[model samples]
Target chain A: MSNMPTESQHARGQTEPSHGAVRTHVISFAIMIVLTVVAFVMVGAGMAPWIVVPVILALAVIQVGLQLYDFMHLNQRGHSFPAFFITSGALLGLIFIVVLVLWP
Target chain B: MEAQPRLVNAADRMELGLETSTLEGRNKVLGFWVFLGGECALFASLFATYLTLRGQTLNGPTAKELFHLPLVGVATLFLLTSSLTGVLGINAMHQGRRRSLLRWLGVTVLLGLAFLAVQVVEFITYVGEGFGFSTSAFSSAFYALVGFHGGHVAFGVIWISILMLQLKKSGITARKAPKVFIASLYWHFVDVVWVFIFTVVYLMGIMGI
Candidate 1:
């Protein structure tokens, strides 16, 4: 085990402070909050359904992407299997929704 | 050029995070991800059901009449903030800061509890307003989808609380790190689901579509 290269050596340069990570998370949080507020305001303002619906749905998708990639660490290295699993599941789920909703 | 030595010291092991330091730990993380995938599909089916039947109020209160934007907006803030705190706990775990991890996880549990409390109140209000689960197809679907998400949040709160106790006892080790990491992933997944719920159910419902 001692002779094998560690992931940290290859991926992370050194044992640095977690401030950078904290900053990244805080920034993500800010962006999510802004997206959420925008969605809420658009709806509360009684905008046309045609414009509000698709836009809020898009915002939701963006927020979920941020949660998955940033908060869940899917962007990190050595996560190919995890990524594949989630993406496939999401794709299947999307198909289910579309097919089921459009059936009638 | 000479090859660099590949000796993994304690610091390296710590930096790699005990969760992925060993084959077992790595497998545990992978398996949890698979489980999350299954959960995603499960929730999606519920979402589909809800979307299909959302307009069948059948004399009961419509979603626009039933849902209060301010309450739901507050609940979203709680869950969203909880998600951030949960990740911070994981970050602290990676840093080997046990106390920080505990503190952040504790805050997460509180936020989760707050979210649940808000949900309980919201449900009560709905029931009082004749929006019971059996009132109509729309109500049934709404409760099923939203209730399931609430159940996940409840489970996450309990799960993280128990993990906190274990961490306090055994400290953060390879065996426990994966457990903590997996729980956080589940929490984040729950939050992700809520994003859709708020958008599709609450926001759109308010729009009367």
Candidate 2:
């Protein structure tokens, strides 16, 4: 990236600091709210239990991703460590939960 | 060559937590991330334990009986909005808007306090409903996970309060900027935990999953 042409570098600089990028967050917030509503509807609509559960869970994953990537600025540069460590911890937790659930 | 402008007037804009990308600010932020990493592991274990014990109730009120969705839904709105307010505060910090920063942060703090108030009420309601901490395995796990999260939120409130005081007195000096940034991150992390709680514990339980 350092060796990039000045043209691209200038473009990158323009979009970088990104306080103006908050519009993305507003949009993300909208999507998250919609997703939350959908999740509630899915569960409360009295559909088949199996179908509703996975659908809610899937919407939740999207919301989590949106929160992490946009709201928390995990998608921003210079946050590699925070992103890595956070995901690692979550991964560890998932492994443990799976093991415990499957344990006889 | 990247012109390293060391100390771009620490008294001026403390955006990247410093004028220059000094190792001090970098290390501080890095160290805080490392701390959050450990925090994740800690919370993960709590979550896992909760999941395991969620069904172990010995004739006590099950999750379906105890969880009131509307009340939790309101609490969710508070915390979720606080998370957004926190993002605004952080944006203010980045833009070097001191007054706006304080205003946004103040709003964030207020929302967090409101969330805590609702949580305390919820706990009281649960206890009154006979879902006290020692009532059953499910009760204990529920308290352990959600209660510990509430404890983190409490600590975050105090932490941000002190940071706000420091910011007010010192302005956006490098000495305090990193601290403020980390505290903001901590607040967001707390909200993330709640997202899962709202899902796995509340929504799933509501679905009888």
Give me the overall lDDT of model 2.
0.76
What's the TM-score, to 2 decimals, of chain B in model 1? Answer: 0.92
Clashing pairs for model 1 are: none
Candidate 1 chain B minimal-lDDT segment of 10 residues: B4-13
Per-residue lDDT of candidate 1, residues B34-153 (tens digit): 999999899989999998999899999999898999999999999999999999999999888999999999999999999999999999999999999999999999999999999999
Pick by lDDT: which candidate is best? Answer: 1
DockQ of 1: 0.50
| Candidate whose TM-score is highest | 1
The whole-model C-alpha lDDT of candidate 1 against the native structure comes to 0.90
How far off is residue B135 in model 1, in Å?
A: 0.5
Question: Which digits, one per residue and each the tens of the lDDT, describe model 2 over residues A11-97?
Answer: 233322565667877778788778887877776676898887778778877887887787666775567677888788778877877
TM-scores of all models? 0.91, 0.87
